[model samples]
Target chain A: MAGYSNDHIASLVRPDQVHRDVYEDPDLFDLEMDRIFGRSWVYVGHESQVPEPGDFFCTRVGLQPVVMSRHSDGTVYVVYNRCAHRGVKVVNEECGNVGRFMCMYHGWTYDTNGDLDFVTQSEGYPDLEFDKLEHGMGRVARWESHHGFVFANLSPDGPGLREWLGENSDFLDDVAVSAPDGEVEVTGGVHRYLYHGNWKMQVENLIDMYHPAYSHESSSAKGGQQFSRREGDKGGIQFFEKRGKVKSMDGLGTHALPNGHTWQGGLPPVENMSEDHRAYVALLEEKHGPNRTREILIKKRHNVIFYPNMAMQELNPHIRVIRPLAVDRTEIFIYPVKLKGAPEKMFRDQLINLNRTHSPTSLVQTDDVEAFTRAQEGMMTSGNEWVLLARTGPQESLESGRIRTTGTSEEGMRNHYRAWLEYMCADRPE
Target chain B: MTKNNRSGDNQSAFGELLFVREVEQFLFYEVGLLDDRRFEDWTDLFTEDGYYWAPAEINQPDPASGVSLFFDDVPMMRIRFARLRHPRVHSQIPPSRTSHSISNVTAKRSGTGDRVEVEARFQMLDYRPGHDQRAFGGKYEYVLSRGDGGRFRIASKKAVIINCDDVHLPVAVPF
Candidate 1:
């Protein structure tokens, strides 16, 4: 914004096309970190991640380090990871339990709720200069949670997390009710992969059903035959049509919700008769009754992107946090979601499936990473300046302001740019 | 070939050394198949119910307990290798070339059945055109059974990379 005006920023985004600078420019990347990630309800770690008081998990909101800790009063707090003195990062470990976060430099300490507790050599500093309340590890402007998922905002002016989540809230609710205990927990372990591409590439790919048939053909088909992704899967989603042409995934449908949220309709049902599956269904039946159980077992949605930072899939039951390292470097952390009170074997199967689908060596995702890295390098071409997103179909508008389109439609990516322009061009107090 | 002769003798010690050397040669050949990109042939070295596991977590109790980089059973291995052969496999366009090195080899005969438990340290240098070269090092644990004609087949091969928990780029090849 220093050299470019608001009009220049608006010029970068079109209704169906966006300038490659959105993915490649360092200047625009900085603006995104400030306007989009800085103001939005960026996802912090889940509540279940720090179940005990004083437990903390260090993560990043954009490029700045932040900590999410549970206080003794049972409240979860998101605060800057910087120390009150000298700006040193206070927490070095990924996640751990500590009574107080003591800065290694000069030994300043802070409470679990990020309140500055102790500072050594107090006599050397003027009491008037160092106010305790003003010097603690800085908390984010606002923090909130829905069903144990925590999101923190660096700005206080944006809509509340619920209002921002919009219709995606129903996606979360569907996930919760599908579980036996009517809850879900982020646990077991995380599977992570890094790609030499922009962070938004992963988010947009989540709802883009068109690419899978081409990008993931290796994993889904071989020697003119389609293979099941899971060992016991009856048949995976058909990538090739009966006439040897690539099948369009439009039938599954795609939804472009407000504020950049997007989701794809449920994947075709695959075969699984494992005891764990039966037992999980039985548990849901006992709670919701036989008729309601049938509805619960049917997946309501597949991949749901929560825009800018996070995405989750009900199919494999995991959340992928897209942490942008730089304009061109991004790290994606995938945490397997466990349905509370379901058979442990079901969770085990989920982990196994994710290993094959989401891990760095994942058969399915490796090709996706390949596409992303190539796109990052190819976008440097001055040959064609604009990256296209112009695919369309019969659009249906929902009462909640969400637009539904064909699964292969590029509406999802267009929706993201719509929100992107809104954020990048919005007036901010200097 | 009797248990009576396999106890506390110089001959038994010599026999154990010979067996370990034989297992090392077998391990070398198995890795060679991968290096040569004879992936389908690599599956032949596995037993009927054999598996290749690369645990994602350190000291992972079992494949079921935690996620793994790979947990391919024999059937999965066939499917994986078949995919690798697909010409349109974008991840394998330039095709990852790997040089595998095995060291610190140790082996012990199991008390029951004609099985040997082998552990070896391994490092693999993998490279694809226009991509950063990566080195993957790990400890390989194998439960190998001696089959007909005294052939050794892998019942299970677990490659526990030292940096298993670290974030990694797409690894198209097994370590």
Candidate 2:
């Protein structure tokens, strides 16, 4: 963090390439933890995670552990997990219902909404001006929820969450309306693991459709075939055989939205409607009518990367969150989502697909982890100074003020670096 | 060799000493098959409708409703075996070598049928080429039922890993 000046930081990212040092430098990683993750809107969790009052879920914004909680008045709060008194982590478990977080150290309490409640031996400090109101559990600077997915900004300055999200926010809407009641819930527990690689590798892999044919050849052949047979569609084999043929531009495409957000729109392998899927479609048809339902369900989207941390696969109904523990280590948390009013069978099937693709023993994801770690290892070999991001392909200026590129193009990566540079060079919050 | 009159009795019928030794030998044999990478022979130890489940959480029930670390019915297990044998699986290219140590085995009648539920603790050391060695320990619950010729076949095998929730290393092979 000490040696990285603005010019040095700016030199790492070019129009078509990035320096390998960005992925390896501890100081630069620390700088990103401060300048990028510290200022941007970091996704915390779904509102449904803490639906009732007094519920809290522990998460992280950058390297800082924070808790999202629901108060009695139906308000959600994103507070740093550290206690105001002794700086101890107030909530220990991953998630639970707590009336108030009482720090085990000295019995300092904070309400579910992150307001300071009581302190032990308060009267002893007579001359000390300890205002309890100012000493509550430290809350994130700015927080908001879009369609139940909550995000918090560590720095007070920046655009609102809606403006930051812009058109990319529709991805969440699509997921919500796909549910019968136009709502979704976070259920089925969490599957988390650590990869021995940089966080950006996983972030990039989220939208990179180029790897499946080669990296996941066996799984796509074996598991995909079984999955396709079950769906009674030409999904498994056709996906691998014709995957490369379907360029990022032609059949499906990518949209480089503002604020480093990117969306990959294409039919996923598991999009085929089974009986349960049909039932959910019927419910959607009744609720939103046929035309809107078709619009919602037909325009299939594989996943949406909200930059830095979250990637949501709407069709599969799960979110992959990346947390950078260190320059060489990253942790991932996958949460499967359930539509509120959808049939149990639909949610059940979604969980099955989620586990089959992304779990620890997943047929598809294990290879991706291998590639990421290998890439990390290769970068350290002193062979290449510049990593290429110049996948030339068809790109268009969209009417919606977004850029459309081939689904496999490195345009999304370039866009991400552009945003990263912008955030890094921006004026620091006072 | 014909039907015996001890069928309806308790420990007196199965004879606790013989039952314990038999189950221990069966588990040891199964371990050898897995360690030797004889996947097909290992798979044959299961009944036709058998399940191999490793829950994400320690006490997670019904993988259909929740996520699981590994849940394979008979056909799904076949697909896994086929995938493991494939030459191009990048994760398993050099393949994983495993050595297992199973102990603390105990068996009890399931109380509903002719099945005995066996419980044991297992520690497996997995070494994959070009990767660090991974050590995994867990409790194994196996329900065994007598099949044709009075041979025991696994109705279900559930592995509850102690560190399932911890940040896991790559799991290319079943624990």
Candidate 3:
């Protein structure tokens, strides 16, 4: 076995290069689950997912399967999915409205708030010191919300939600408050897909703007075929122009912001803007006035990685939560948000765009997944010892310990690596 | 369900029209164009402002607020077809082979001359290299318009998949 130290690992991460083992090592994956996932504020489910009393959605927080539920009084709660008696999962279904969760093995029931309501055969445990309050379902260390997006932390000692969010909080505010009523509801159900790559690979690709012009060239070309023909030009410009119209589809690459927040700029080309989108923007301006509507419309971002696991993309009204299942496999749960008061035509337009561009069967996204999966498979080989992150524009301004890079920079990936190292190397407080 | 009589009558008439063999023939022809990968011809079946929508939720009426699996207009649909048939498009290198079966045709007049709602159950088999053939079964809602030439043009094609919201492999083809 090769003896590795923090210093040795740190050497692999220069301003430009990273060790290949970071992507391939099983030991490193475990360290990530404990250090990164164990402490970061991981996104759970939106409040709308559990709107009704007793409505719950079961998902993962790190390696733990936790259920997010709404209580009788409308407060949302997150609890361990496992039962206390025999360790069986309390809820087997993905989502449902249930007054209480009963363990199948022993029939112990817990209320929506995760409080133990009753035990099977109460008379048999008369002399036992079983306390219903003490034996309730296990709750997460911390749970909070920014807008309606819910998140939880497994470690109790991490920073508060506001502090962790830092500059990204402003972006979150824009996402939430941009709506006409300043309230957003998850209108559509979630879209789930599996990536045969490391969870980090997906996160890295979220801000990697360079890949689309090449990897998604086919889809972009496909999109371009609808427009009038322009001679002597490969479809790259056409794809970029088309994608650049929507703020969400902006092909501007990565704009690294402070606090590990980054934005992809350049609206999809105006030429490709749908008639409905143009009309909707006009109507939004008419209703909310031009300035406010422009602020919402122009903040084009493909995906905003809120550090670690939560990624929000307003373009598709999509939010993806990454849960690492193994060293190589990652499960991404995608939630597509619906603008509550928007016109049916507008909503339909957005959905079609999302399915065609971002869905599992999307031409662009499938190629991306295939590339990442191949990367995961390739990293397993002993051929290369390090991965190169040394792309253009690594050094940029740092605000409050966060880094920012220009539009065509790889700083987002470096920022992610920096955070990864910080979490992985830091000694846990006992 | 609370029955609205006028709308119900319109719906029944529309359903009766859809059950006719001619309507089924029209649907079969449309599916054939798609299955044959004749994208340009497939797109000609839509009106200028027609929409193709596959919702992420079951029985979801509005598309504006919710994220849809797909909501494409004529231009977008044209682009999709172009890419699916593009040679440089690596994902389409082997190309996706699909077979669609449309059955259980039912139609209803939706209280408007411009609108006729036709419902059908469809099963699609899609195959590509290195992946198993994926089979999708769903109910289709086609809102059709009567063109000047007495042919039907799609106003809206809405597919409500049985596993609509589940995480799936990339959906490349129009369902």
Every model's DockQ: 0.63, 0.60, 0.38
Q: Taking chain A by itself, what TM-score does each prediction score?
A: 0.97, 0.94, 0.88
Candidate 2 runs further than 4 Å off: A221-226, A229-250, A268-272, B1-14, B111-113
The DockQ-based order of candidates, best leading, equals: 1, 2, 3
Provide the RMSD of all predictions against the true structure, rounded to 1 decimal.
Answer: 2.6, 3.5, 7.2
Residue pairs in steric clash, candidate 2?
A1-A27, A248-A406, A248-A407
Cα distance off (Å), candidate 3, residue A19: 3.7
lDDT of 1 by residue, A77-170 (tens): 9999998789999999999999999999999999998889988988888744765558999999999998888999999897999999998888
Estimated TM-score for each candidate: 0.96, 0.94, 0.80
Candidate 2 lDDT by residue in tens digits, B1-175: 3346445455465588788888899998988888999888888989999988888886687787578887877877777778787778787878999998899999987776579999999998999988889899999999999888877899999999898778776787788
Clashing pairs in 1: none
Most lDDT-accurate candidate: 1
Per-residue lDDT of model 2, residues A1-430, tens digit only? 4766789889999999999988888888999999889999999999999989998899999999999999888899999998888789889998889888899999989889778898889998788776655788887899999999999999989899999998868777888877888888999977777789999999998878666667777766434334442342544444433444422233567778878898887654444567877887788898889999888776566678998789988656788899999998999999998889988877776777666777888877888988888888899968779999988578898887789877778888888998999999887768
Scanning candidate 2 chain B in windows of ten residues, the lowest lDDT window is: B1-10
Q: Which candidate is the best by TM-score?
A: 1
